[model samples]
Target: MKTIFFSFLFFGSLISAQNSLSFQAQLPSINLWTKIPDGPGPGGENIVSAKGSVTHVSIPKLIIHQPENPNGIAVLVISGGGYAHIESGSEGYPASEWLKSLGITAFELQYRLPEEGWATRSVPFQDAQRALRIIRKAAGKYKIDPNKIGVLGFSAGGHLAGYISSTFNTAYYKPQDDIDLISAQPNFTAMIYPVVSMLPPNNTTHSFKSLLGKDSDEKDQAKLSVEKQVNAQTPVTFLAQSEDDPISPVENSILMYQALKDHKIPAELHLFQSGGHGWGMGKKGTNTGEWTDLFLKWLKVNGIYNSDQ
Candidate 1:
């Protein structure tokens, strides 16, 4: 009887230790705040009734999931909330848990939102880059492979992921942290219903204007379009979108796939006839949930998924 009691205690302690380790491996929290100016007036000649600024607003709530295999591959996840708020359920937790089940480590990134500032277009972009560097720095300790690290983003977060894929070499800000020296480029990118264009002829996404602080000019607009940025060196990409998505048009993925093809980059696009937007892992029998299987297939074909099984 004593032996059995000790055995139960040992197993219980082991489980508790594992849970503690998991929590410690996630993204660290940072200070963030928004400041609004004091005033009261009706607009007729001159009035700035409400003006605000975001200060000490650092990226927080990054959560990491370490895989059982301890292989080198890791994926950073960026959740989407229309650049306004983060959808923790659809865009964050479910995806992270699924990646863990597949023996793939995951990180959930919570970047700054538009309520912070409109004049600054590079803050959130810089945050994405920094997150990658942090992963690389702790590669060995976290059992992650630096070379196999990738990124996945949804909706507006997809736009940020797309930006990182294209401008990996661009230095947006000075590196201050220990992880700064590592490259920000993801080995591959998985974008779901991403917004790919902001230029005229296709200028429809208002989120871009709000983030950029002003409507993009011809040159700047062209620069923001990820479709035009694909190259031979760009990471392997997998794109999925619903044909009926009202917020992000399906054409965005189509155009990006064509660009990837032009550069001979490994790319796969899956467009469902009807899934609408933000179905997130999807409801029962919905098409969006099946995307996970398709993504895994792509990973296996690319040699990213280990075949030790």
Candidate 2:
């Protein structure tokens, strides 16, 4: 019996290694759809006619940098391109590589967009939830610790990540296969220039309307604003934004941080005076790029970086 167990373990390890190698090779070729466009935008007061989709899909590219020592920390990275496209190079790859260098496994999620239907809010959210479950289901194979999983997103992706963190308990779609058994809650979240407010004062951020749909009325708006839904159970969040960001204002992160604090959830807000929006990983010598270092330190202070556990 002992010999059979040992043989199984050895074979499993070999198989996992082979699979990882194959995945690495194929990562470059994986073309995941950000969203399938529905038609033109929904022109109206406060609502802008933007590209949208019905069935948004995500293709996660897993990169393992520090393969020798797995830190148990896994980050699901979401890139920002409003709700129209995904900035893969600037936001996705660079951010993932940074996490990988820190011994943390990274999964770059190319979530669905809002170009399909105006009334559909479930697509992108569902994709995020599915991605989390898929990662957790294959945690052992990926050499990732299931409990230490977290999420990071930029711009619209930031909203997606925040939504996932808040709505882990809300089931929008049926589970697929056994992977559905895992919870979708992100242990922690890091949002960069996220769009947290969608109502009147933040009408300029049409990304929310594009995602949720044009018909998303006041009630729906109230429901989707993650800042309003934050609770004690909300994951610890680290947020950063520039004051001069034209796409997403600094108030977005500020509102989220305030909500988190109100709920007594551990939260950190780093508002840089410069570094206008969409500077993924930031340019060299810029304050935005410095956010990564600050995030790492915050993680350490919060005890999330402890590898011993």
Which candidate has the top score in lDDT? 2
- Tens-place lDDT per residue, model 1, 1-309, is 343334333433343344322333354432211221111111122111111111223334356766677666788888666665555445555566668767888887766555554345566676787778877777887788788889988877787887788788888666565567778889989988888877655566655664654645778877878888887778999999999888889988898899889999899999988888875555343466667778878888888887772
How many clashing pairs does model 2 include? 13
Which runs in model 1 stand beyond 4 Å of their true positions? 1-58
Tell me the TM-score of each prediction against the true structure: 0.79, 0.79
Global Cα lDDT for candidate 1 = 0.68
lDDT of 2: 0.70
Instruction: Output the TM-score of candidate 1.
Output: 0.79
Evaluate all candidate structures by whole-model CA lDDT and list the values in order: 0.68, 0.70
What candidate 2 gets wrong by more than 4 Å, as runs, is 1-68, 117-119, 307-309
* Residue 136 Cα positional deviation in candidate 2, in Å, after optimal superposition: 1.3
TM-score of 2: 0.79
